[model samples]
Target chain A: MKNKIIAFFLGLLILSFAACKKDVAQDQYEVNPVKLYPSIGAKNKNKTQEQYVSILYTNLFQRALSGNQLVEIIDCLESIGDKELGREVLISNFMNDPQVVLPSDSVMRANPDVFTEQTYERFFVRKPSEAEKTWFRNFIEANPQLSAEMIYFAFALSNEYLYY
Target chain B: MNRRKFIRNAGIAGAGAFAVPYILPSGRLFAATGRQLAGHVVYVLFAGGVRQQESILQRYLDDSQGFPWAGNIMYNMFNGPSPENKIVYGTNQGNGVEGGTPIPQILSQTLETQGTVFREVQAQSAGHFGGLNNLLQGSQVTTQGLKQKPINPTIFEYLRRHGGFPASKVWFVGNGIGNGLPLLNYSNHPNYGSQYGANFFAPSITFGNLGFEHLSNAKVYHPENELDPMYQMKYFLDQSFANVGKGGDSLGNTEDEKQDIKSFMRSTYDRVTQNAIPFPTITENNDALNIGFACEIMRWFKPAITVVNLSSVDGCHADFTGYLRALHRADHAVGHLWNYIQTQIPEMAGDTVLIASPECGRNLNHNPIKDVNDWYAYDHSDNNASRVFTVMAGPGVPQNLSIGNEANPVGFTSDNVPTIGEILGVKDEIMGAGFLQPESVSLFDRI
Candidate 1:
């Protein structure tokens, strides 16, 4: 009877402990995952907000924003922040404000490592994967003329940053 | 000892619910393998229940008031006599005498002369949303609850998956975004979901003064000297993201496609700023604004398929006269938009097909309320509310064709989707997917 009690308690303890600790290794996952990320709300409730989603979208194709709303909407705000606010204060600042800048080519040339680390931490929330670091470094070296904002923007607006 | 430390660390990391985002999936999982018949389709979810008597039957008051005061108030789509003695729908600003506008009537032609219409169509649901669901999804999902993702896939999904059309090619230009109208672009079906969805936006919200200031002719950010501003912008974006409630994911465009869309968006914004396209002049009515934008979309993208909702006429619950005015204006808007597509949009003139239907009809019995015009107000909850009509015109549609009069009722509103599928050349694959309501059939086939 004593042995049985110990076994049962042991099982209970194991279950409790297992539930508490998520592996840190799993936390980082893959920087460039082999499989496509499930879209926001597809597999589960995983999607970045407009800023990250929009930024990720823009960096992929460096330029202006689109006039249309192509992405998903919430149950409450069927369209978005009151359209006037979305248009006037919010979206305008993201796309129009010239002061709202990306990294210039010269700055990126001067400090690629710092820019890279900041990107991984801010966007991916982790250290750069060797593959990602190597590829980006080569990209910068080859296109030394690319702006600093381009690299930062890439990470910030990357689909990776859009972790659901 | 370290196990406790690991647990603590994991808790901290998981606390914010932050984690590395999985890469977004891309590639045409299902190429629009469906056949292509019509180059473009413009569908109008003519919302708010239109009573058979007031609309198709043109029975102005015989049934309601026991008087034969009937005339064709909706003259644009149907081939019937004009509401000559009754012209209350137009603007009275001319002489301040009420009920008149100089806006020339569309003399080009009526829909009956060029298309097929079902006068005694059967609408599955009397409610606006479900009726719209039936129209878009081609189903009669009686259990579909209000303000939720549709269980079945929408026509938008079929167009993308079977037709192999890109997201850029499909659009849902909505009226002011309310009543969950914006949510109809895609559905929650696992197989056919948001990835194959339409781009929806309320033009009034996105194209007014605010839009002019921000989106139209906007400059790209420099990003170099703008770090602080970027931070501020990021903060705003983060807040917007944070405010978003609940979740249901949709498919996203590829990086290149997204950029392509962005460029197109910029060009469209620029065009709006420059007033390059002819935006119809709408003074009093709200539905007219939506129609005008529909014309703008046709001119801009020439989208393979587009759906717009007209809801201003749903005002019949109280204001009978007002409902008539709005209904009349709705017809005028459709007429103007259709005429623009034919006479102005050279590319889509002959190739495009148009479909229009009310969600359902109103109740036969009158409500207690009476309008200022002394006409009785009617609500929609009776068996008669299921009675509605369908109008379709384009290349493949039989001209001067009228099917199923009131006595010999012969069609369902759900058939519109399959009819659209047939017209667009994807009926077989869409039907093969097997989500459409069993009753759904191509009106063209029926004809």
Candidate 2:
């Protein structure tokens, strides 16, 4: 029993000495230099990084963050998107899941304006004004690259998603 | 002489009809004392009802369970050896055959040898959320409810507002989001709401499956992909916030600070993957994981203030043996954390101050159910649940000082707020704020 106790004390002594290698100037505070953490993007990305990351964590990752761990948040989002194939299945399932369901072509032909209310109500959380609607319809025509899935993904990653 | 008295005398108004308001209860806060004794403070809400006898007093099972054991399982904080009996709480790797080697007491000097202790502290509430509110907000509000914002300002707000510290400098790192723990980083008080709130995040969630799924690549989207999700997710988040009653949670950092945190988190990931940062040997326990990540935050940002919560021991409500094991492990996690702070983190080595106390304590009597080992579990609903202790350790604290007792209690659970405020040079500001209990005196003042 005494030998076991001695071994424990001996171990502690070794651990303690191991950490004391760096001799320090006793009263001075040693802080890491400025820009110690590296940010990768240009000013625009950096400016909106908090809002973007906030939306992703809140909506997709489904949690609240204090906003300190941005790298991990982005890393988390990309990995989800990397599984876009698996998530394509999820997206389609979610489309069928009450919230984002769209009318069939024949059904939509009979009630073309039905989707306008649904789109504004579901996407913006509010109905769009007539001027706003006209601008959006023109904008969609002018930008052929904008797809419905891309639009959903865009809203999921937007600054507007996080702003009060 | 007074207007009210004159009105009563003139029979123009009934004397009891006029409402008298107290100064302290009025939500308006006062200025800070500005005694800033330390650069940083790590307040460990060492929660989930730890009893004094089982903890600081080191009365293992002799008192609570009627066993022959009577020694300290928590050798790092208090001075003593663990009890002599079935010590199953220590890590056991051998399929319950061989116990993991007990972590050697990490601190050469026990917290008691290096700091002051309040042997008896009165936790105002036996319930989890209420006790937590009292501990962080520094006032016992019996009317406070759950799933809503705290009624009074937290120490986080007091420190941030009075000390001119940014949101990143104040952090509340919760172990898990269980028990509605995430909502506590800010309060509902209009004067000092989310803007003065602490930057709070659950590390377990961030570093676990969530991190793996979404953040691994962090691929930036094209302009077209970006604009589409904006409106849709807004509606989702708006409803979510409205449900929680904090309709808007501003990230609360300047653009530079936000960028700094982003870069730091990025740098941290690179260093971590490269093995530049020392990851402590982890255990299966959630408390240990929390301590690990908390140490990471302190090392990376060295936030002026950091708060951690340990609640695994809450298992005591059903399984006493599990509770005992969790308590023992909680001590072990704390020991590793302090050692890391003292030895590994050069920035916080000598500059940091640490304070810890349970949110509340379990009842003195045992519950009806028994574990496989036949040890009975305990509940915290009894008034005896208010019995708890507080520990403070750092250079600024008086070494080896002991205060309070069951017979003549000296402090309330709320006292920790003003006490830490005093240590960090914000005592006057915190007390002057007037939201805390007027009687919650600083430990420095008591000394």
Candidate 3:
């Protein structure tokens, strides 16, 4: 009887050992991507004349415009009926000013990816998608004569710039 | 292929080419139906507020100031002798008198003899803005407000939307931007809005000191290399944004037209510096300057229609002597404009129609205000303000004919729009729109 009890206890111990075997060595990697805007659809409101002039002056000069100068600029814009042509002329006039700040062409060409990303953020207030970034980088690399001033001009005159 | 089969195919192709309806740029499947009278039309909203006593009536000071001087000061537009005694409505030759030397007439023949004149016409509005609206919109909506666009389509829209005229072919030149002069280029009507608006220029602000300081230094971008790439980038950005909404309304001027306009602005700036604008002999006032710019615009664009607004004579509310001087100068300006078209512009010579009318008339009675000459001033806003006149001259207008004497008024100021439409071969389209004043009709029909 003693021998039978010992054997039965031994079988119970073997069953417990088989049932408690270690869990499989599975690994997990937490994925949390930084959130970004999907598209430009969120910006819907149009900027007023004052807002446009003020923001444009600040963007180019890194300073705020005075009230009297703002009025004069508005007058210049109002004198023209075609708002697009008016903006073109006004931007060219600003570019002609000696104080207009722009980076050198060599700097832009050396690190196109960084320059383009910064430009997109400065003007559009958003990061460019991979496709947009790649397209711009290719465009800049192809055209050696293109200047930062011209790119800035294009951005300032863009239809997207007219809205907030 | 056999010769007989080739001939049959050629005939079929020719027939199809003629029978099939082609669409115009304005999206119309057919061309205008009315017969065009002239290739161009120049409508002048003659000085702000002219008095019948001083203008068409030729009463001069006899009717306004109780003086014995009774003669026409607008000899270029009317046929009458100048006042021999008190010749104060001319340039001051540094004499003790303020105005002593009258400007010589510009036209060999007066407009009254050259074409038909409506001696007395009814003005729909006593106010300046409303009267101007009547002349352009051909409708006097009681709800029309100041400083707002017209409620109905203007002649510019009618010609562009129905007549298929391009934006560069229509223009409105204002003396200044004040008094809502810029708003007259387009209307708020949903059917015909900004896409068909005229290209407007308030030259006093556009080409004056302000323009010189701002617009004279535009950079000339290369068409193939620079501008092409820039425009491509802009288009991409626009497409991205357009997925949501449009940015702003455009006047529908093609890129080529916009470039041409920029070139014109550059040349005008150079001309101003050289004192080469075609100004009248007595170019002392804003009216003369405005007309000079109008002449330049016509010379450049050869537009289908050009409307020039002159308002210097509005000073008459406080100065009668100044009013007379301005009236004489206004006549000189008109004479210069007509003479310029015939002599300077070969394309428009003898083919353009000239129409002129005052927005409203001044009060028959003088106000309490007195000028430096001790003469009483006149203000508008009475029954007399509704009394106005219209003068038409050009190819299809009747010569040496005068209708509607002071006692028998014949036409309304709103008739000018339909008259312009008739001249441009879009009268049927405009009349069918059902937006014009009920009584409005072509002046030719009136004849």
| Each model's Cα RMSD | 18.4, 23.7, 14.5
Off by over 4 Å in 2: A1-122, A125-164, B1-33, B93-101, B220-247, B264-282
Q: Of the true interface contacts, what fraction does each candidate have?
A: 0.11, 0.10, 0.60
Q: Give per-residue CA lDDT, model 2, range A5-80, as digits (tens).
A: 9999999999999888788778976644523112111112222435555544444433455655655444333222
In model 2, chain B matches the true chain B with a TM-score of 0.84
- Please write out the lDDT profile of model 3 over residues A1-164, one tens digit for every residue: 99999999999999899889986988976546634445677677899988988988888887788998898778877777777888888888888887877778888999988888877777777787788789889989888878888888888888888877
TM-score quality measure for candidate 2? 0.68
Which docking category, incorrect, acceptable, medium or high, applies to candidate 1? incorrect
Q: Mark the regions of model 1 whose C-alpha exceeds 4 Å error after superposition.
A: A1-95, A98-108, A129-134, B1-37, B61-68, B84-86, B93-95, B101-103, B217-260, B281-283
Residues B1-447, model 2: lDDT tens digits: 999888777774444345343222113233344766778899888858877777877877787778878888788788788776677666665446334345456678888888988888888888888888888899976668887778999888887777667777888878876686876887888878777777765666645556434332333233234433433444443443343233234636653455455555556556556755444453567887778778877887798899988888888888877777777778777778888988888888888888988999888898898887788888898877888888888878888998977787778889889988887878887887788876888867766
lDDT of 3: 0.89
What is the Cα root-mean-square deviation between model 2 and the actual structure?
23.7
Q: After TM-score superposition, what is the CA distance of residue B58 in candidate 2 from its true location, in Å?
A: 1.0
* Residue B93 accuracy (lDDT) in model 3: 74
> How do the residues B276-312 of candidate 3 rate in per-residue lDDT, one tens digit apiece?
9999889899999999999999999999999999888
User: Lowest summed-lDDT stretch of 10 residues in model 3 chain B?
Assistant: B240-249
Better of 2 and 3 by lDDT: 3
